[model samples]
Target: MSTTETNSGTAPAQSASALASKNPATGDVISVHAIQSPEEVRAAVERARSAARSWNALGFDGRKQHLLRWVSYLLDHADELSELIHAENGKPVDDAYLELVLAVEHIAWAAKHAKKVLSPKKVAPGLLMANFSAVIEQHPLGVIGVIGPWNYPVYTPMGSIAYALAAGNSVVFKPSEYTTAVGNYLADSFRLANPELREHILTTVNGYGETGAALVTSGVNKIAFTGSTPTGKRIMAAAAESLTPVLLECGGKDAAIVAADADVKAAADAIAFGAMANSGQTCVGVERVYVDKRVSDEFITEIKKIIRDLKPGDAEGASYGPMTMPSQIDIVRSHIEDALEHGGRAVVGGADSVKERYIEPVVIVDADETCSAVVEETFGPTLTIRTVDSADEAIELANASRFGLASTVFSKNHGMEIARRLRAGATSVNSVLGFAAIPALPFGGVGESGIGRIHGEWGLKEFTRPHAIANQRFAIPGMALLSFKRTKMTTSLVKQTMKLLHGRYK
Candidate 1:
């Protein structure tokens, strides 16, 4: 690893062209970044492409070693990385550190398991191809273009990046317009660990929508994009021009069900954290809550108490920071207003909580299904509470949304039963967003929640293509359709064999 730094310790001045990263809590400038041009992005992709060939040729053991070294580096410098994440994304230090920890685990998981999961496995060729032996292997798809979002920036993107690298594909990462500095820090750290593979291994382009579009159209072999559903659709369309495959991780209107048998306090606390942490910028954050009518009043009161205790600021002592994106303030305001206008009550915080860059936790109750706050992906520190007669009703309401990323069931019994009917990719019983922490479980959703899985063995295969190869072991004359010669006797024998093999009746 070289101490050689490219454009470190120096940043573009705070000008019109600079993307200024602000502290979500205090609204102070944490760093300034220059949005790279399209040509510069092209160069970065080309460098990654060159690096990928050599990096990919290193075989599984060599790649695993490099990944382990990278993990070691992250552990050695965990504090520094945590601070950078906090400064860039405006979450509390604990949240940042936790994300870094999860990322480290993801990196290690991808490294240690990629070989076993992606390597070829023998399969029976079957009676049709009885003379052949077949094997299926997952092959690297070459360069992958990754577009990340701001919330859990490290954890979310690494789900794609680490897995892609493990699958032997180089990545050209373009982080959110709001969190470019975090992207830069990660890419730079990788270079520090694997200097020889620096060019082919990783490269970052920091910018906004234009930069992301450039990456999507940059002729990469595949695109792994995580953001809003609309953006995911756009990325898919752009990649369609090149017929490039994509793994889209998009938005969610996730719900948390509080059954009659659930603990009110525990459910409330889970709701508070799942909705307000990261200022609710998380894709799988719980935006809607369906509480049993039997416990609706008690649950709402407890949840309000939890929201009241959550303080949002840029100070060191705060639990959460501001909305990282300056424009999100308006979005948050609009959603709160829409809820209020629709007869919803903000029991704790309301439109008044929407500050310049920060938003206090808002818990809205009596929200109708048609309200935007209840239906839309309100990526803010706000939640909508609804009541239903039974757990079945809760599942029905949760599955009604087009987005089905992750859902939670809080019940002493029937938790798993209700979870199964939710139509989401993942469900956490008696917990919120707990599936994401388990490295072995697949993480992703069906429908609008996005396409493709991002964690576990599924993640490792998302960046690779399954290649099936068959070898002929022996030849049987007149045993199959390979020859058009006289085969009346052979045909009778084949039909009898087929019937015996399949155990079919007359």
Candidate 2:
């Protein structure tokens, strides 16, 4: 699972002009990947465009077999792929394995449901056009360019890649520079699975942000981008140059609400895992928790017990690994400091918890709502607990952020009621981040969190456009409705029908 092995299997070895992928935990150079120039990105998009027609012609069944084969290939090599994820992303081995499992499930789901979701279906022509037979179908948007994030690199990106391919479009992926090796490994595996179509199918363009910018404007039919909000906006703007539609999955300041009747222990465990897993680098990771005032003390006690002994390091038994991005450490530190300065009390770790690369879990209580720690996305293993007078207040506070990504509600009753009230893309009742594990659920957010969705049927449609067709069944005798020779009798009949349908409804 060495970097050279990963890169060589898919394509030729990286040339001298390449970027180094370093391990965030140890600061070791894990692999060298060729930095694709803008020209190279455009070339990859062109290749995908050329291959899309034949791939789509294979139809749903043909594509399903190839995608299922990819699933099997990925499952067979899960351990190896997980190792690459660990080496590059600094996540614990088990976490990386879980990510791979979810990614495989998404691919399988997309393949199995593509036809059912995207196939043409008859539609009623309405009374005004009863003589016409109408239908609608989803057609591939040609080539799709995906800009993936580093955290959960495999799972997050595949949400776009798998569905885009399932819907009959060729993909040109630009993985995060930090996880270039992992991306190359996936592309290589896909090529191996479909060797005959390798030249026209999935392609990987390894590089930094500039490479991603190039991909956005690479003349692809559409772009699916997952990253920070600012970056998502930039990608959208770049794609606008080509009028290429973009689906953005951006950052989230997700919140978890605990009702008075919730099971304290279960809620504590779920929140702890949701907040600290992957060192809190998840896009929908739990960053805030609003609890009922009646049970705030009990909830805090239970959560503290769950995380008190947890450690953050690269050790075998550590709860999580180091921060994937070095710059993120400063962000985490600043958030913790701001909370403490704004009338917040640290229940677990605080300013001293942030190390060179690893950040011990930090839990702050009673932080001011306006503080940066509570208002912005920290993307670290930090949680801010704020007590609310009632469930309504909790919902209000949760919906206060500009981000409306994902949320969780823990309650013995009224879970669904509260979940529906939260203005987020998805909500998990009685659990944290459970929506992500369900392949059928759509994932994305509203407002500043970004637009569009990935996963299930929504994901299939995101990479396609609707094409409607209508056929005239039989023309009425002497109708001439569409001709200059339209008869007065036909006009009178049509007017009378419209009046009968609408004039007396009330």
Candidate 3:
């Protein structure tokens, strides 16, 4: 209900004391504002539902105009927005800019591709149903509830948010408590460009667990959630009460495989970014690196050199930023301790590297399979290096996980082949997290990594429902049926036709 303007003039900055947006680098409060009460949350949803009806009525072209406005607004304030994201999330400024660029690209992709992918298509009615013609199309699901994560705060949430909007649905976003300010900024900016859509298009609610739960229970037609596997399960269970459909992008223990034929320097550089960028807080960040024995020594040496060049600080030249969440430091420390206890060797930095708010990158080898560092989601700046016999063995180890969000393969000889073998939502051949930037690719994972997808066609459909219409042509009464004398001949003809159409083949 209240809107404020920041430097970009999107919205006024909320007082950090009231809402509390902290600087990940210094653990200082950036700003804060009022938290929305349950009643206010419901009211927002109501406004969105009302807006959805009119927005949907605008049809394809009308919705596209609104999307373009949002894109323009995002581009106009990208620098200021990126700075805000960096300050709040502790990711490097470049990485923050990258997220903003990709978020804008995704908006463009969703706007341009939604109609083509979701439009009606005619299907053959087959055999006994030959007299009927069928068509299937997507319909808006009304209100969508999005619960986003802090990592890649802009792009991650926008995956669902943009697609939901493209599909003609209103969204009420509840971003991670750690990144609420960014969420508020995005929602407020969207309203500014399309004030006519203020009530219907987008809204933000700030809080922690209870707030997220309330959004899931606010009678939204669908929910799109991105977070840890444990929390994803809880969201699913909560939505079951309302039978609301959900799309979850959960945790991942994603691995980067280095083949014997890989360029060691390139491989090491890729691993460094995949593992240490954003202080290694990405859900799809490289947690483990498996190299062929033939290249193990060389790969480790190369990775260590890159790791040594990295510095953790709050400055521009620093390769790594501070941990966004303070509690994450303890978890990172615990994982390092477990890895050491299990006979792991720290090739670079170690436990003492954890500062008040920043965590330096630590590379460890000889990590036991059962060690928490190897098995759990540290979500910090750390990497475990392991060696295997061949690409097959590398993939085998990589696929052996409860989480399968994303992966990377660095084999010049057979990168795509090996990448295809990993059980993950997206795999980048010779690159890290490259698939995330391609708005055409559907993003999500399988098994414990979570279900459903966001991005591309799948993302658009996730927030909409199928509206099937079958128009009856004319009443066709068989000559035998008109007399109400269903003869054996007519029955025999029907049976014969069914067999001819659907009989099992040899």
CA error at residue 217 for candidate 2, angstroms: 1.0
Q: Estimate, for each residue in 24-57, the C-alpha lDDT of model 2 and write its tens digit.
A: 8898889887788889888888888888989999
The candidate maximizing lDDT is: 2
The candidate with the higher TM-score, 1 or 2, is: 2
Cα-lDDT of candidate 2? 0.88
Expressed as tens digits, the lDDT of each residue in 1-506 for candidate 1 is 11101101122233545687766656677777887777888888888888889889998899999999999998899899889888878888888999998999999999999999998999989887889999998899989998887778899999999999999999999877667788888888898998776565878887667777888777788888887777788788878888988898778889999999998899988888999998888878899999999999999988887789889876787978877766667777898999999989888889999988788888888877898888888888999998899988888898999988999889998888888888999999998889988888899889987899988999998899999998888888777556778488888887888888886665
Q: Once superposed on the true structure, which residue ranges of model 3 sit more than 4 Å away at CA?
A: 1-17, 477-487, 502-504
Cα RMSD, each candidate: 4.8, 4.4, 4.7
Report every candidate's CA lDDT.
0.84, 0.88, 0.85
User: Candidate 1 — which residues are off by over 4 angstroms?
Assistant: 1-18, 484-488, 503-506
Q: What is the lDDT of residue 391 in candidate 1?
A: 89
Candidate 3 per-residue lDDT over residues 286-345, each given as its tens digit:
999999999999999999999988998878988968877767788889999999899899
The Cα error of candidate 1 at residue 136, in Å, is 0.6
Candidate ranking (lDDT, best to worst): 2, 3, 1
Clashing pairs in 1: 24-322, 25-313, 25-314, 26-314, 51-200
Clashes of each: 5, 0, 9
